[model samples]
Target: MATTKTVDLILDAGMALVAGAGPDGASVRAIADRAGVSAPAVQHHFRAKESLLHGIYARAVDCHLEVTAAALLPVVLPHAERVAEPARQGVIVEMATSVMQEWLREEGRATLTSVILHLLVHAVRDASYGDLASRWLAGTVTAFESVGVAGTGDAQFLVELLIGAALVSAPGRFRCENDILNRELFRSACGARDWDGGFWLERYRTRHERTRPDSDPSGEGEGLYARLLDVCVALTAEVGADALSYRKIAARAKVAPSSVLYHFPNRTGLLMALYREVHRRFMLAAGTEEVEPRAQAAPAAGLFAKLIVDEMAGEAPLFLTSCELFLASWREMELAPDALFMRLERGKMHGVPQLSPSERQRAHLHSIWSLGLALTQYSHASSHRSRDVELRLRDGMRFLDD
Candidate 1:
């Protein structure tokens, strides 16, 4: 007789496994074993592995909302009518910002976020799982509305940006850019007017770093090396990083398994190579110079937004694969440092002309928001995909004209 307690225990065990090792770790039998229940019990509760995965995410999301209750109360609780709109909005924005900051800084919440993202990455390919992901995002917007923030484009992007930051950027780095990031976040979250771009421009100029990936050694034949990378990228985009095996790559490339290993000795090396290759493809596809640290001249403000649209239209597999890798970096500590650099490097500021400081900042900001948007929307129907990308591009371009 499995009670509600039995269901909770099963969900707890599933989340722990998935969070630590991704979707592959949370097998039905394994979850049941961890929960000290028979495999039949897990089946009885969730009915299938897919349902169990969905259940894990639903539980995690509910727990997140539960914990967030205390922080949101400053805005959630009713206020006096005498309070000015600006003052009340300020409290709401402040509370939202604090809650997001905790998502970055707090260990328990961060782990839960990782679990959510892990399942989300799965949802990109799994239609059944995508329903839960969609509901979770919509519920977030509704949650924001309850706290007085309107469901404007900026507010939507702010939610995406916070989710993206949790996916890729480290907590310390999020704190480092807190002031600049929050200025932008507050504008979007609370509908505040835009401010000076000088602080962001100066920070962009001084703080951005460039480190090139290791060049492929020619001893193993550069052609073979490049071929291996192409296969890895395609497979990763089709399947996922977790499902990638050396045998799989070799089979696709029609090369010996040892040859694949000879060129790339480990999973980390292969992933790093894949990152550089993906970066090169993005630069070339955007009509920017691939080898340079910055573009020849700054691209137009909405250029990256257009670039995102194009990628979704044509190169969706690659785009989603990049999203998977970025999120994976957050969960895998050894990969975090280089992956962080790779992510920040994608939003270089030096090459564009007459670019306003705000535009430059928005360029970087939109890049993050795009990651979140693509993750959540890519699994939808084709018509919705086009509409969402267009809306995202429109919302992203709004700051450029200022």
Candidate 2:
């Protein structure tokens, strides 16, 4: 039998290894070595690699919930009896901003979040993992609720918003200006009035002005490049970028292995190119100008419904590949900014010029909300039909306003 201390060592080793090098570097043998145990000893504790990964993720979530609750309980407890409902709402807003600020200021927090995101990517693709992810999310929301976020919907939105904030503000890579937007978003999540802070929105320039895959700067290798990227996208959506390789792409695309290398040169470049392509596709999907929130809730709800249905129907690979790569890119130092940019300035917000100022602001929020919705849907491992997904999306879009 494995001692509790030995199991803790194994779990800690797995978390640190995954945080540093993602799932690819966190093999059972590697974990055992890091834990100063034999491989068989680690296996005796975890049973299998999947079980070990689950243990690591579950442990991380437990620590996160404990820490967050500790930070929030003192602040919220005093107000629990003293405040009226509206005053308590104010307290929730204050705590929401405090949570974001504390999250941003904490040292080594991003490392832990990066590990969670990696597991979250796995959850997006694997149904069993998705069930674990869903439970983690529910547990997290419950933690927030215990600390004063009263409504289930409000608590859920804040949790999702924080996840986006963590991803966009990767360790030491996020822009300082964008921090304002996040704080404002935290307030908005708690039903606080919108802050007049659109300056940060203007600072984030979209990397590619054109959101078309065919609009590559170098026109050379158009046919083969597109074919290779298509294969990479499919593969990355299915298994994630860590498992991707030139030979695998070649085999899938029916191109020579050398050809993929010629176009991409390295895995980092290949992943970035796929990120760009995926970003472009997402832009097109979200570029529905006909659906304006200010017009009424129906059009906006319909747009989100379409997007979610497309994701569930496998018509849009963006929901799968985009978030997966976005999380995975946190471990890739050179790719961090590009990933942050994709999260910070989702391609849709830049192209839509018809929105009013507040609408534009809400558009940015809606984009993040949509990403969260996709994450939530997949985390629950829903096998809903398009109509079911559409119905759920319609209900979810009520969160678009503050």
Candidate 3:
């Protein structure tokens, strides 16, 4: 019989492999090898690959939720006592940030989150998983309420936001440039003393300009092209790519169907154009044109993360729109290529201070510290407490370092 320690060893190895290569990558044979066990030995312990995966998934969810609870416990206590003054609020924010950074640094958490996301996508399609999922969600909300944050709706929103952030920042996975927006939101929530919206807006505009395809600079093709792009994006967000028709876009854009065809010519052309437009906007929103791009980019990333949490916590329409976009992109990979480009650009644009390979890794580690800190905005479960969402945004720009 496998010792308890041996079983844990196998599970740990399996999780590591899954973290690096995803669930598909963690083959039973590979896991067995990693665990220094024969294939049959591995099977003896896990019975089946699905069972092993379920174990890992359950652990990951529990671990993350535990970390989340630990982080929020102090904040909730003070808020419950009605002693959440500005200084106390600041401490709570800092504490939340620190806990988030810690969570992000934990590779297990990231891997588990990825696995959970995989499960969630499949669960949404499978009715059999409904009861299990509902139970999980309910338990999660109850946990938050127990810690002082109140309301099931608020808890659900925050959970979705955290899940969305995990989805967006899944290591080695693809995500939209909207991550910048998420980061900006985090900074805003953290009580930064010098948040600057104009700075982010300008950076967004510059990024947009860089990615836009060369067009008739004379402005002849600009209007029709712009309208077509807008309509396609709107429709894509509305009914998804398969349901998007030129006729629908024309109706939404209030342009004639003939005008839409005049610019796009075909569905492929329209899809491509729409895809390009989303990337263009994402780059514009996420790129750095500021003199100190990394410095600027870091805060923006933080702020954007916070905003996502706040909006999702409120169950706002914009959050729903963003979620739809995220889900649609999964089905239409073409619409979501921006995630890859954004990751590359972030690495390149932020590649300054001339660090060695190890140093670069360390810097990335530090950036991820902020990344996790930014994610805490999504873990709270109080809609009334979230009234400070805009306040957090205002405070974010206040702390921009030179």
User: For candidate 3, what is the total of clashing residue pairs?
Assistant: 30
Query: Model 1: which residue pairs collide?
Result: 297-351, 298-351, 298-352
- Candidate 3 lDDT, 70-120, residue by residue in tens: 767766665664333355434434443443444445445555554444445
Per-residue lDDT for 42-159 in model 1, tens only?
A: 8988887777888899898787665555556666666423245566556655765766766655467766777777766777777777777777776666666556544455456556
* Model 2 agreement with the true structure over 228-281: per-residue lDDT tens digits: 777877777777776577888889888889887888887766767887777666
Give the alpha-carbon lDDT of every model: 0.65, 0.67, 0.48
Model 2 per-residue lDDT at 70 = 62
> In model 3, what is the error at residue 356, expressed in angstroms?
40
Could you estimate the TM-score for every candidate? 0.80, 0.86, 0.48
Residue clash pairs of candidate 2 = none
Candidate 2: 10-residue stretch with minimal lDDT = 206-215
Please report the candidate that would top TM-score against the real structure.
2
Q: Pick the candidate with the highest lDDT.
A: 2
Ranking by TM-score: 2, 1, 3
lDDT of 3 at 10: 79
